[model samples]
Target: MYMRYFSRLMSAMAGPRPVVFSGPSGAGKSTLLKKLMKEYDSVFGFSVSHTTRKPRPGEQDGKDYHYVTREEMQTGIANGEFIESAVFSGNMYGTSKAAVQDVQAKNLICILDIDMQGVKNIKTTDLNPIYISIQPPSMDVLEKRLRDRKTESEESLQRRLNAAKVDMEISKEPGMFDATVINDDLEEAYQQLKQALLEEINVVKKVNMSS
Candidate 1:
């Protein structure tokens, strides 16, 4: 009976509030994510993404991303080492199984910063997560932010604007995500995200008390 109870307990604790944060290029997704990681510190573990693209200036390996060769990535994919992966702009990016495991082993909430394609793929898997999409207030505002960054060429900036349009449209789909957050106000958006993450713990506590 104790063994059975232990099994149930583990199952309950197995997927503790891992979040998949998806948004467009200039949607302040990374900004909000950094706040969570920095403020919460020990509570969240970032599953560093793997990419076949060469690192841009100031990016670090295993810190910003795990840089790998296309050949190596394909081999790892064949070996079942990636949970979800996608090709964008002729480069491969993925969340590796090892990266997730590393965070989970520490009992931290693993945060995955993936795209819409990765989000779609993850839903089919058993690694259930709270899906949240951060959206800009408007396309014009999104365009302004991208332009202000000055990090993109005109062509790349246009591509991002188009992608944002699609993302905003899809985010409105009821089943695509658990929550759609507008990032017009940074602090307000952060508060919303923080509360959502906290709710998972609250739910489990309520269940335990009743059980």
Candidate 2:
């Protein structure tokens, strides 16, 4: 009976896992993650981020992102509240340990939409996360999507395009990610992501059982 109860406790503690998504700007990573969240009943959506950027129109605090002032963000960093933080294009963004803990408490899989720096930080930490790279079908599609956004000036657009090129180069390196899914077809991409997640979960479970 004691052994059985202990097994049950361990299973509960293991709970849902965590996954990380990284990609270049306009790679459709966000869209694919949203779809995966909607489709997977077991997945818990953890808003694993806080940003210094002002919320866009219709964006809600805590839901879209934990909107914080730069001063506040700096303070948090000093306090070691953030698991990882980075500055991108003059904006600060980070994932807090509290944010990840909140999801872990509920036994839900937390998904982090992060950049390369954030990914590197997570790898060094205790959270053994599976990383996935969402890739655009082609540079043409990526450029078209960025143009459609209409939120960037000519200068800003050029900067983003240049960044995207660099991001793509880094993402293609061997051993960078467990899986890479091209976001050209939504349905296909989702299926691939789902399968990759299941495989990761299974590997974790096997390790747990063996241990």
Candidate 3:
């Protein structure tokens, strides 16, 4: 069972570092993240990002995203309120500094799920987060996974594959990420992810046990 008592252990012991998760689409990043958070919900919190796009059905403001107008987002960006921002499909998306601070203030490690560009942008700031990249075993495997989803058109699938190629290559660059997890098997990959964070986990455990 999880040590539920240590919900605020991270904040009590130390200023927890944020953890950034980035990978190509269909690399199982979201799945792995879901598993981690489900098991250690108290230890991690996801920072809500801001977007200029319209919300889809069932999405809540300040929960799914801090929905904003284009003018508002642009103002925030100009004011340097965002830690990282990017324009896609004529809409802007970003993680604001306040969002990360909100999670940290709750005594939890803020988890950021972003793209390669966001990673690079964060690197310029002083957030000093642990960067982790999730990747598929190979391009062939990634292609299969995307296809198996059965949710993409041929053009969209090809576009994702193309982007994945660039993402995979960037992941290999020197010092781009602290850890690179190749998701060959779900269980094995999850174990590897936990292993990489074992030090932090143990720290939390030690703090909880001592208290």
Candidate with top TM-score is 1
Q: Of models 1 and 3, which has the larger TM-score?
A: 1
The lDDT values for all models are: 0.83, 0.79, 0.84
Rank by lDDT, descending?
3, 1, 2
What would the per-residue lDDT of candidate 1 be over residues 147-194, giving only the tens digit for each residue?
999988998888888878888888888899988789999999999888
Q: Whole-model lDDT, candidate 3?
A: 0.84
Model 3 lDDT per residue over 52-139, tens place: 9899778899988999999999998887677789875467989987788788776677899888889998786666788999999999
Ranking by TM-score: 1, 2, 3
What shift in Å separates residue 92 of candidate 3 from its native position after superposition? 2.0
- Which ranges in model 2 have alpha carbons more than 4 Å from their true place? 1-15, 200-211
Off by over 4 Å in 3: 1-14, 56-58, 205-211
Better of 1 and 2 by lDDT: 1
Q: Where does the lowest 10-residue lDDT sum fall in candidate 3?
A: 1-10
Instruction: Give me the runs in candidate 1 sitting further than 4 Å from their true place.
Output: 1-15, 201-211
